[model samples]
Target: MGFRENEINGINDLNLCDGEQAVNKTELIDHIATSADISKAAAARALDAMIDGVTTTLAKNDSVTLVGFGTFMVSERAARTGRNPRTKEEITIDAAKVPKFKAGKALKDAVN
Candidate 1:
């Protein structure tokens, strides 16, 4: 199947498909378990560990770049206005530090 056919790839895979990389979470767990020869629980833990580790690193405002895969960075989102569609009321969206990934060349090429 084409990479586009795999929705569970990750957020990165999704972006890459739309010229962006977006892979879903489940697929990561499956990949971790299948490739590591570990149980799903173990894989889940490992995946969580990786995510937590990255999150922690980013929390400190440090960037993590996994060579040949992608660079994970913390991005600051400016406060903005938002609307509640149901209530039809305006709201202030607070600024936030968000995790972002820029897919590496290898990953981009592989998808293509």
Candidate 2:
């Protein structure tokens, strides 16, 4: 049942710096597996589920809030006029619903 045992072992072998190094998807999956005591495949599925749920909720004009983590929501932007830098042509920027996130108090506190 150690389908990802080799990958996990490889991740553990790498020396990761706190803030100096960028952690990629593999590292993230490895972390999830170790922290949740689940298989890498399960962790990947869980992450995918979370992403899909957030995207679906936002598409419905709703938000997803992980109490101690953050909130994912769609914010509206008003139509505005803008100028193109290269051609210096004026343009109308259409209003749209953009995704946003605000970290929760716990997450903020944890970082600081």
Candidate 3:
């Protein structure tokens, strides 16, 4: 199934990197289904599984590396003092562990 420009709903008019149109999760699911010759439901499940696995690993302070694709890791962000722009009031920003991604060489080269 394909969606014409007018068929999609609730999508933002946002241009992404290199001026390419932004693709949402639904579109990505469709692409995975088509490329892998799998049912849409299966593709969604696979995608969800990958996401859950990565999240679980990160939560454990570990990283996931898909050789040429990329690596998913977490980084510690130290707590800091921040200021409110409008009120000029000081605020406390708590430390947190943020997830990060680093693209591998092959993925970078494929894009370029």
Candidate 4:
């Protein structure tokens, strides 16, 4: 199955094929458990630990790079002026640090 440009409405429309569905955390945990021959609890714990590790590293303004997966890091967004739709008033948008992810070459290739 393929996606047409007009068919995509938003993130929720990402699964465009019949019998295809987005996999949630529980499904991921089940897959991990079956693949690793571990219990569901262990798989959940492992996933949580991995998430915590990435979060902690990003909190320190650092990056986490999985050789064939992706890199997660913090990116600084500059402050800017914006418009209010209702009032048509000018507003100042504050600068902030946001988390970003860049997929690695191997991950990109796998997807392609």
Candidate 5:
């Protein structure tokens, strides 16, 4: 089958699981086949390199600020308390390392 409705709705057409510019093997191949008019195998390697570059750089706590695109960073979430909506029970949320993105001013302006 192709991509599910929820898997692609309103998401970037270039970054769909089944559209193009996907992060997975099959989708990456599809993307390469279409966008760059490249062979599937070559596209796969390109996607791999892109993903590896992002992962290794982020691991070092360095922000990948794609000026006017956005900034990708790893941030620590301080431990905090939250309530379970269903049970209304208080719970302690453990601290976590999370990948975050803050769109640049240009992006925000474009969105608005």
Candidate 6:
């Protein structure tokens, strides 16, 4: 099913057809505000702070673990040779650090 911007009132209003449903930042903030009995602005600030914390930790090549949620860390990728899809030319892919997340057992269990 297709989703409309106006159709979303909160998380529960999502239509999960073939897992196509998604919760956008605004919707999440709304949910947080209602659940925490806070204002939307406060909820947004809290969400932004949490994201900033995770990003800052990952930038230091460290991991942030929320016991019942998940762990976010940075993983290094080795430089490798790859072929360009359009030109079929060989190119070297540079090594880099990328952020990764591993769901905790509690989160996994909640999903299941």
Each prediction's TM-score versus the true structure: 0.62, 0.80, 0.79, 0.79, 0.59, 0.82
> How many residue pairs collide in each prediction?
19, 0, 0, 0, 0, 0
Score candidate 4 by TM-score against the native.
Answer: 0.79
> By the TM-score metric, which is better: model 2 or model 4?
2
Q: Is candidate 1 or candidate 3 better by lDDT?
A: 3
**Cα lDDT listed for each candidate:** 0.76, 0.80, 0.80, 0.79, 0.73, 0.80
In the range 81-101, model 2's lDDT, one tens digit per residue, is 999999999999999999999
**Could you give the candidate ranking by TM-score, starting with the highest?**
6, 2, 4, 3, 1, 5
Judging by TM-score against the true structure, name the best candidate: 6
For model 4, the local distance difference test gives 0.79
- RMSD of each candidate relative to the true structure: 7.0, 6.5, 7.5, 8.3, 6.9, 5.3
**Cα lDDT over the full model 2:** 0.80
Candidate 6 weakest ten by summed lDDT: 1-10
Across 18-89, the per-residue lDDT of candidate 3 in tens digits comes to 545666788778777866789999999999999999999999999999999899999999999999999999
Instruction: Summarize candidate 1's per-residue lDDT along 1-112 as a digit string, tens digits.
Output: 1124333445323322454465567766665565567998999988899889998999999999999999999899999999999998999999998989999998898778
By lDDT, is 4 or 6 better?
6
Candidate 2 segments exceeding 4 Å error: 1-21
- At residue 46, candidate 1 shows an lDDT of 84
